[model samples]
Target: MFDPVSTPDVQALVYASFAQLRHCRYLLLRIQDPAAARRWLRQDAVMGLLKARGQLGRETAQDEALAVAFTHTGLLRLGLQEDADFPFPSAFREGMNQPDRARALADANVETWRWGDLPGEQRQDVHLLLAHFRRTPFDEQGPLSAPALQAGGLELVQSVPTCPAFIERNEDTKESRLFEPFGFRDGLTQPVLHSTAERSRRLQQRREIDREMADDSVVADGEFVLGLPNEYGDLSYAPDDARWPSAGASANAPPHFGSHGSYLVVRHIRQHVDRFEAFDAAHPPPREGAPSLTEQMVGRRKDGAPLVQQPMPPADLDGFRFRVNDAEGFQCPLGSHIRRANPRDTLGSDVRSGVANAKLHRLIRRGRVYAGECQQADHGACGHADGRRGCGKGLFFIALNADLDRQFEFVQQRWIAHPQFADLDNESDPLLGGRGEAAFSVQSPTAGTRTTGLPAFTELVGGGYFFLPGLAALRFLAETEPAPGPPAQ
Candidate 1:
């Protein structure tokens, strides 16, 4: 029952490409007649157009498809609400204010983080990856077609302003940078796309039969992008008659579905690297033949593998190669920042059960690290360097899913902040866990383990939640706004 090549992994590859191609397009259409706008929503023509365009494969019209669909008003606007506890003392509303200060701040922040501490070889790899994800403007294509407004129909309104930071993280203001909120080198982990081959590979990796469930659950292609069917026998966001008053559904019926759309939560988190480093320096773990501060915090070397579990640290390798892998809290403390965030093998059955509760709740993370200065090769050796000044270091954490409450929030509030994890004294996330009123400490029990105390950090500047609508939704929105014309006569 498993076909490797044309499976979900391939679909994911195609879809990811599609998502990048589509980018963000916002639109503003003005209707000459109010009745026409209502009529447009009632018809199925707009929906049909979206379906047809989505069907086009990547190779054929990737560029054209993107050009035709995205707009300044429809796709580009991310509806973000300000968090109540943002720590910034000054209110800098516009992105362009005090150009020199913003640049200096961003540069200083980047310098302080010691991103340059990474070996030259590692730096090159990171730069290449960052460049690959960058987006370019649509210069090749001409302006898009303006919608015609018939009697009570729609026309183009004012052009929506472009927020360049939406696509790229802020490059100025060091203290308010985005990326690595937790301070680890690679703070975010991304999900692997499930293609048929990918599924087979996963099954083989877990040594599971094709039909039976594997160790790590395998998600079908539709569950993520198109929204798989749920146990309630209702599609997510389905506009059934009973559920939606607009569709004339019964009061008990489920709401109308927007299967193609997904919810995205984008947070602009600022990292207090200076404070974190200072704490590490002040509380130097009684080096009674203990593991170094870096090892104690991450449970691994810079290369990203288990150092405690491996007898011999891999030579010339950034990480260690473990002879054994243990999901239990022994090897890597359960509360270690990375373990708390992912818990891949630790939770086992509990994780599966959680997944079954709401299948559509799954989300994919696509994030980037922005730093103020390129880490110099010698930065990490002594650790006490003048903090860089800039507003361009931190994480641009983005989560995409169909249901916000079930997926993104569940992961953030439950697993990341859950206090009852096995073997850990408290519920502090190793990397980003400074929440409560006071600082807290957790003991990592291993050959060279040391107890470390983490402090509470605050989020100062950030944005809000946004709905990434489908192409059909954009056209519908374009045709609904009231038109500009001679004073009503």
Candidate 2:
């Protein structure tokens, strides 16, 4: 049974990606004045801006929703005292632009990023990220005007620009699904939080089954939220306030700061659609009966079906594993984007251990596309209508995890960016991997392995790591005074 009280503390975004709310805006902000920011945080209007898990399905504004997250700097600016004994992880504390971490993320040119500050670089410091969603397009006077942002003590550090959400509407069923800028289904395979309403809903709707199957989709709650058991059957580590008390220590110490909180990874990944299209057109399918170049790279068809043929139902597209179904990657390329992202049952010493180990590094992705046209009439492709050069469109990538090092970073460094993945050398992930001259090897049973030179398709523009705090922790930051200690430098 769900903990009615504690579960409510989780943010609504943790439960739902708000994909139905097509019109979305992401605001990157910097706190100018601590007192004014604290005052703004305490406001009833500001508090209501953030929604909780229990508040879902009952939201009065069915077309709109809002959520907020904070960087380590943002938390400090909000008067959160630095606790030496128990602190946030190094990745979250140091920020995402750390020179070493940036390299791991394949952000080769982070120095040229419009926003985000590197270590010792104080020019651009983004403290807060406020995201707003709506069904209808935002008018000329968008949700938050310049003056309104100023009034809230938030210096507008340029809106993280995003185009309208891409839609693929089925005329017969009147059902609409999301697509990325590259004209492929987005958010198909996501980690379902264990014992939540979403899991129950999926099971009830027959989207998934509740058996002792090999499906790695359903993961422990602690993988995405703190203070819960993870796939390893251990409670996730959280920042305990009791570890280091204030001068006048009392029995009533504040709750663990990270309890119910999750680490949020945000990346502004710009997709070069024109370049990708040009590349695809240039490289047609190597074999007569093989898939297209785009399909080879993405490891899925345009409608989001896996390349490998599985015996599962259409709703269970993610039910297949690499070792059991396509060990040789004949059906799906070994170095494909989805395979590298989640190499289910193929990375360890054996199939069973590999599947179990992969569970430890799972991430709950909540991303959306921005600024790309789609052709609903054509069931095959849905990209730029004009196919213009330098189309300013990409994905607003967002992922949540309780352990950053093990989940997001590991996938990025060890798999996506690792050129030697799956015993293949000189090739990273075809779609989201490192830029410059790269190669993709597609295994074939009859024909020899066809290797294709791949150009950089995606580039990381701006990104940062943030802490999506629980409602209780949000209130603590808003109302309580900083613990008596020297502020962190």
Candidate 3:
């Protein structure tokens, strides 16, 4: 059993997915009145919505969780202004809709996003993101209803619910399984938090459970949380110029403003399920002894197993490393989706250094699969090109990182979208490359390289960068009085 005394003052969602609660509702909101919003944040209703890290293990199996995050505009609305004195990273300051950021992520026509408003668009300006996870079905009269939101000085921008088809329940064992719209098992591999790994280790000692079944690498606490030493033994901050507000601390003391907090990267990606399946059918395996074309592209089977030819014995699904087992890309192609996503000892000069370097760019993902009807009028029926009716499915991808530029952005730009990644020519991440006519090359030991067209299987419909403050910082934000304004222009 975990002792609740030493738990960090971080939100539960940062360390837990709340997988027991299969249902979720993503509420995008706009702050209508800053004063009223702050007042609402201080209310018991809001304070009790989500548990702290310590309170998580004490919760009942049927408990619901609500995690709140604010975008740059949301912070501004909540009275956290950006200036030299109170610094924020440029990525959060400029947001994901900027033209340069759009180019960086290979996102086309970001001005046409369905969620946040562009300069000239009529969509709502999304400021706050509330992720509500529960075991019960979505209720219209839930705490996040229009009336409740209005009481909090907020107005609903949009409500995205979890796709029912993405959840599968086994009647015999009474276990639940989650899969993305593309039929691949989702959330199989995740980085274990320092605190979580400690608890798991204790549990393992008590029950004597096999380590392979629960294999997860523990990352540096500072890699995902502020005010702690990261992999490089430095306080974590993105882009080198970002600063954490001291909050009136001594020179030797750590800053408290961003401590235990994390930056959350949220993206609404629409997956073209039918198109992907059709392309998979059209392009079968090139040779008799190879996996399917889509399997080669994804570097994993639909069951979430890696494509390594001979996986290490007694290792779990995420146990094998590319450099140690498949350095030549003969088994798992160098440019495959999973390879580019993590790389796993395949980067840097050698295996040991590559493993260490890769740890600096890791992300803790807490994404959920989303499917249903098309909400955006402009974006036609999810990802269908033939104008099909009632076809919408995608992923509500979220990642938590202390440094935005080093972790998430680096993975997206340098690894996933880079055409020359791993010395491969004109090849990007086969799954999320977003290129219309991209090609993927499969290296063969003797049969030679086989190439296939890698069309855009997913499209970025909406995205925003948010700061998920620590519980203490959230309270500070709630209680903070408005800063003195400059003289009216």
lDDT scores in order = 0.36, 0.74, 0.72
Clashes per model (N, Cα, C within 3 A) = 66, 1, 0
lDDT of 3 by residue, 1-489 (tens): 223344356888888877777677798888888888888887787788767876766655536788889887787777764445537778877887777887887877677788752332633558889999876676657457778789889988888877544556565685567677776777766776655655476336533333432332556778888766688878675221122345364453235566667899988889988789898888787678567878878888777778885443524566667776788898888888888888877777986677778888889888887747545433322434543322337889999999888899999898888888888877767778743237888887887564655567988778878888877767767887757784111
Question: 142-194, model 2: which lDDT tens digit per residue?
Answer: 33566666877889886754444365445467455777767777777888778
TM-scores, in order shown? 0.51, 0.88, 0.86
Candidate 1, residues 1-489: lDDT per residue as tens digits? 222222221122224423333222323343344455445434454333232323544433333232122111222111111123421112112111123422322222322321121112211101000111213443312223343223225454322212222132332431112123233334223343354344566556544232233423444443443333333334444111111123353342212323344444444455666676676667565656444454445655333445445333333111211113444445555555555444553343554554354243445665443333434321122112443322234554555654555565555555555555444454455555532212233344545343444554434233223444444333444444333343221
* True-vs-predicted CA distance for residue 430, candidate 3, Å: 1.4
- Give the range where candidate 2 is weakest over 10 consecutive residues by summed lDDT: 374-383
Q: Candidate 1: minimum summed lDDT over ten consecutive residues — where?
A: 123-132
Model 2 gets an lDDT of 0.74
The segments of candidate 1 whose C-alpha lies over 4 angstroms from its true place after superposition are: 1-188, 193-217, 221-223, 230-234, 239-257, 277-301, 306-324, 348-362, 370-391, 434-453, 456-460, 481-489
Residue 73 displacement in candidate 2 (angstroms): 1.0
How does candidate 1 score on lDDT? 0.36
User: Candidate 3, residue 248: CA error in Å?
Assistant: 8.5
